[model samples]
Target: MVKATINNFESLALSGKTLGSISYATRKSVGRKSETDVAQVNLNESLETFSIQPQSGFDFSTSMGTKLKLVNARLVATEARSNGRTSVVQGVQGSLLPVSDPTVDEYDEAEYDMVFVTGKNRKPVARVRSKDAFDSQDLVLFGSDVLYKTDNRNQVIIEDDEAQKSGYRLNFVQSKIKDDEIGHLISIIISVDEYERLAPSLKPSQKYVPQGLRVAFVGNETTNWTLYADTVVPLTENNKQAVKVDSKPNSNTAVKADEKDMKK
Candidate 1:
């Protein structure tokens, strides 16, 4: 039996402020518990032994030559050996022992995979992969635990906070447009690699466009519709095109006397 205290109107039951204590009781009931169980039991023997202090903010684990942060860390890949063994590689961070290691519990990997610590709003920030191969989108994201690497041998590791906060960013190359899909003029940005991704469908042209510039869509006519960025639009009799201008048409020109007579 242990003696404890509860203050500040905080609950002391199994579902309340005492998780470790309840976990201990649960482990004792289950017969499978950690070696730290005895120390944890002694700590709970007195209320003072367990501090009920409130968390100030995000706290990272950086002990025993290991640096693990819930927000910034990502699980990269899990490998299965021929001997029926396995280990997980944490991108930018080292590997962890097999999830079934005697020192670690089965739920340990799941718990650390994407969990935010206390005072961290309990958000999942990363993704985990257990295989070597994955798709193109997975390569751009840090959450994907893939083994794919660039020519430089750098596996892309995205910042979870940045990905959560902002939209997906990519490095694109000049890609061609599908002639059939090119309808009324809208705008598009493409990279060369993106063009290749759409190959066999996209129509080929002689010249390549500069990067990061917006290209307006033109109709079925292929030759005269496309032009360089700085080219001037010529208002001609046969070719009537809508031009984007700085100012709106003058409102005074819209009022007509014939229109007023029609209203009466």
Candidate 2:
């Protein structure tokens, strides 16, 4: 059995230096459209905020996890007008810096004074006052994160036929099960494609268990059991039809369906 821990697990992020889990996301559409249009033909914009908490004893200066240190960081709200215009409104102002950088002399002056704003809102999103030094009081910082349009297609390449066949194979086994432990050892097998498809619909913190799905084991309970689907076809109707036609007893249905049905 393989051992796994959260230490090496990588988390998914939309873009650019995520501090922590995304706490909030807001989308707005603002623009003018003609009478024939169903809705306003405006620019689609989104504003996301991430809660960044400094690790207790982790030194930001030496750690790779901590990307940027912002002192005198402020939260601002901006809105796009329907008349092709935008406005910025300042909200709150405070510092969120690295604990090691109590004095502002560690980082370059220009880097510390830089402020970035999202295209949707023209407000001062975050201020990078110092890279290394931060006040102890500024333990938590809210970063106004921005999301940009990205291609969502999977770009994996299966080098050979064998590799392609094994690309979607996934196995499950309990870790740290001792030889003498009198416990039921359960294992589940699934395809990577199916897992990816079902993962988005599941809760963020949900776990997949064979028992939860009411799966039963056959044969000797002492031995490990594995289950897998034959093959996963693409969810599109065209792909389903292709698979069905390929698996049919006879492959002579080249004629139109109406002609074949009439003959039958």
| TM-score of each predicted structure versus truth | 0.14, 0.17
Q: Which stretches of candidate 1 lie over 4 Å from their true place?
A: 1-69, 78-84, 87-264
lDDT for 181 in candidate 1 is: 29
Candidate 2 residue runs with Cα over 4 Å from true position: 1-162, 165-185, 201-224, 229-264
lDDT of each: 0.20, 0.25
lDDT of 2: 0.25
**Collision pairs in model 2:** 72-95, 101-133, 101-134, 112-128
**For each candidate, C-alpha RMSD in Å?**
26.9, 23.9
Per-residue lDDT of model 2, residues 160-222, tens digit only: 532222112222222333423322122222334544564445332122322111011111222
Clashes counted in candidate 2 amount to 4
Candidate 1 colliding pairs: 76-145, 172-191, 173-191, 173-192, 174-191, 174-192, 175-195
